[model samples]
Target: MKWTRDSYRWIALAAGFTIILVGYAMRNTFSVFYPVIVSDFGWTRGSTALMYSLTLLVYGLFAPVAGGLADRFQPRYVLAMGGVVVGSGIALCSTPTSVWHFYIIYGIIVAVGTSLIGITPVISVVSHWFGSNRGGLVFGVLGAGFGVSLVTAPMYQWLIATYGWRSAYLMIGLCAIAIIAPVSLLFIRRSPHHIELLRQKDTDTGGSGTTPGLSGRTEEWTVRRAFRTRSFKLFLLIGFCNMGFAQQVTIAHQVYFLQDVGYAPMVAASMFGVFGVAFASGNLSSPLSDRYGRVPFVIAGCLSTAGSVLLLRITPNPDSAIIPLLFAFASGWGLGVVPPACFAAMVDRFHGRNYGSIHGTMILFISLGGAVGPWLGGQLHDISGSYFSVFTLVQAFLIVAAVLIVFATRPASMRITS
Candidate 1:
C-alpha cells in the first residue's frame, strides 16, 4: 500500500494535467464563440480575429516571465495565480462593453493569466519530474488536456444555444476558478526536489529509481549560450512556423471554416470535438517519439499537418464532413506529436538549471507567430474570399518547420558555442 517515489511524479502529472484542462478548455471555447462574438458586436472578421491574435501576443509576451517564475519558485504558486487571473478575465468577458474592453480584458489579462499556468511551466515541471525516457509520453499526456475540448466544444455550443454567450462565459469562468485554483495551490510541485518537499518523502529520487531534479543533467546551457546555439534558433523558428502559422489558423478558424461551408453550429463543434479526441490519441502514441528519435516524429507530424490542411482545402462541404473530421483528428494528432518531441529534443540538448527560461524565450518567438497568424488568416480570407492561399502558406511553413527540427536535433554535446 505504500506508494513509491515514482508514484509521486504520476500524481503530480495528473494534477498538472487536470489543472491545465481549465485553461485549455477556455481557450478552445473561443473558436466556437468566434462567430457569435463577432455577430453580437458587429465587428469585422479581421478585427475579431485580431482579438484572438492579441491574446496570443500577450500570451507570448508573458510566457517567459511565467517560465522564469516557475523556474524560480514552485509551479503551484504560479498556477494558482494563473487560475485567478484566467478566471477573472473569463468572468469579466461576460460583459465587454466594447472591442477595446474585450482586447484589454480577454486578450491581455486572460493571455497573461494563461501564460502563468501555460505549457512552459507545466511541461517544464513535468519534464523535470519525468526525466528523459518518458518525456515524449508525458508531454503527450499533458497535451491531452487539450482533449478536454472534445467535451467542452459541444458543451459550449449547447450553453450558447440554451442560456446564451454571456451566461456561458460566466459559468465557465466561475468553474475554472473553482476547479483550477484550489487544485493547483494544493497539488502541484515545481519539481520533485524543492528542499522542503523532498524532505517529506524524497520523491525526487523519482519512482523510477532515478534521482529527479537536475541531478544527472550537464551541458547547462546558460540563457546566453542557448541563444547563440543553432539548435535554439532553429527550435524558435520551427515553433514560429508550426505553432504560429499552422496552429493558429487551424485552432482559431476551423469551426468557422466548417460553418462557412454550411455545417450547423452544434455539428461543427461536435466535429471539432472529434479533433480533440484525435489530439489525445496522438498524445497517447507520442511514446513512439520517446522510443524512437524526436526528429522522425517531428517530420511525420509536419507532413501529416500539411496533408490535413490539403484535405480541408479540397473537401466540399456538409457531404464530406466525415472526411474532414477524420483529417481534423489527424491534424490534432499531428499537433500533439511535435510539441513533446520538440520539448524532449530541447531537454536532451539544452537542459540545465535554466531550461524553463530557454523554453520561455523560444515560446516568445512562437507566440509572436501565433499572435499574427489568426489575423493574417482572417484578413486574407476577407480580401481573397477563399482560404486557398492560406492553405498554401501553411504547407510552406510546416515544411520549413520540419526542416528546422532536422538541424536542431544535432547532439547537444558536440556544439558548445558561447
Candidate 2:
C-alpha cells in the first residue's frame, strides 16, 4: 500500500461526525426532560436545576482524564465504553423513584460518559487530520450537532408523550449503543500515524508526516505553563465571563422566559428549535476565520451576542416572537465561532507534546463557569421571581468577555514546538 489522501480521512470524518451528533443529541435532550422529571418527582425547580449544574461539573472534571486516555489508548474502546455507560445511565434515570437516584444516574454517570465521548475526543481526532484549514471547518461541522438536537429533542418529546418518558429513554439508549459502537470500531484511528500506515506499503518509506522543524521539540508548555502565560490567563477570564452569561440565558431560563412573556409550551419549545437553527447557522461563520482572522470574528460574535441579550431584555410581549429568532441567530454565530477560534489560538500559542492536556485544563475552567451560570441563574430566579436581573447580568458579562478577547490578543513572546 501507498500513503494516499482518500484512504482514511473521509472515514475518520464520517465516524467523528456520527459520534458528535449522538453525544450532543443525548446531552441536549436533558433539558427536554427537565420539566417532566420535576413534575413527576415533585422536586423544586432549583433542585432539578442543581442536577444540571452538577452534571456540568462532573463533565468538566472528567474531560482531561478522558483526553489523556484518548491520547494513550484507542479512542474506539473509550467511545464504546462511554456509550454503554451513558445509555445505561439514561435508562436508569427513566426508572428512578427518588431524586438522589436521578442525581446519581443522570448527573454523575451520564455526565462521565458524555465527557469521555464529547468534544475533547472528537476534536482531538479531527485536529490530527488537518492543519492549515482545520479550525473553521472542523469546529463548524462539530457545532452543527447543536442544530441536530433541535430535531432530536422534539422527537424525544413526542416519544415521551406517546410511549412515556421511560420508554423514550430506553429507545434513545438503544439507539446510542447501536450507533456509537459500530462507528467507533469501524472508522476511528488513533492518529495520522495509523492512517499513514494503512496507506503505506513499507514503514521505512513512510515519514512521521509532522512538520520538520516542528517535530520532537518539547519547549511546549504544560498546563502550568499555559496558566502562567498572559494569553492563557486572559483566555480563561474571557471564557468565564462569556460562558457564564450564555449558559444562563440559553440553558437556565430561555424556555421559561418565553412562557412568562406569552408563549405556550409548544410554541416555547419551537422557539428553542429556532435557537438551534441560529446555532447551526453561526457554525458556518467559523471557517471564515481562517480567511479573515480569529480575533476579528471573536469581537464580532461578542458584540452580536451582547446586542441580542439587550434585545431580549427590552422587547415587549408582542415583539417577543421576533426576539427569540433574533437571539438565536446572534447566539448561534457567537457560539459557532468562539470554540474553534479560541482553540486554534491556543494551539497556535502552545502547540506542545501535551496539547490535549493543556486544552483540557482550559476547558475545565470554562466548565466551572458553566456550572456557576445555571445554578446562579436558577437561584436568582427563585429569589426575585423574575429573570430581569439575570438577563441584565448576562449583558454585562458579554461586554466584559468582549474586552477580554481584545486583551488576550496582545502579541506574546512565547512559542511552543512539537
- Residue 197 C-alpha lDDT in model 1: 38
| Residues 1-418 of candidate 2: C-alpha lDDT, one tens digit per residue | 5534455665676677788788767766666777677667777667777777777778878988877777656778888788777777777776788877777888899889887777777666666666535667766677666455554666776787889888998889878878887887777775654345333423323676443544475554668877766788888777667754464346556766776677765566667777767666766677777788778877777778777777777654644577777776777667556766766666667654455667677667777877777777777877887777877777777778777877687775243222
lDDT of 1 by residue, 1-418 (tens): 6555587788788987887778877766688888999889888788888888999899988988998898767678889899888988888888986888888988998999889878888876777677666777777788777665555788999999999999999998888889888988877865545434334324543466544564575554667888777788888899999967788888888888888888898988988888878777776677788778889988988888888887876665686577767777778888767877787777777765567788888788888998888999889988997777888988899999998888787765346575
| Candidate 1: worst-modelled 10 consecutive residues by lDDT | 192-201
Number of clashing pairs, model 2?
Answer: 2
What TM-score would each prediction reach against the true structure?
A: 0.91, 0.88
Clashes of 1: 1
**TM-score: model 2 vs. ground truth:** 0.88
Clashing pairs in 1: 6-207
lDDT of each: 0.80, 0.70
Best prediction by lDDT: 1
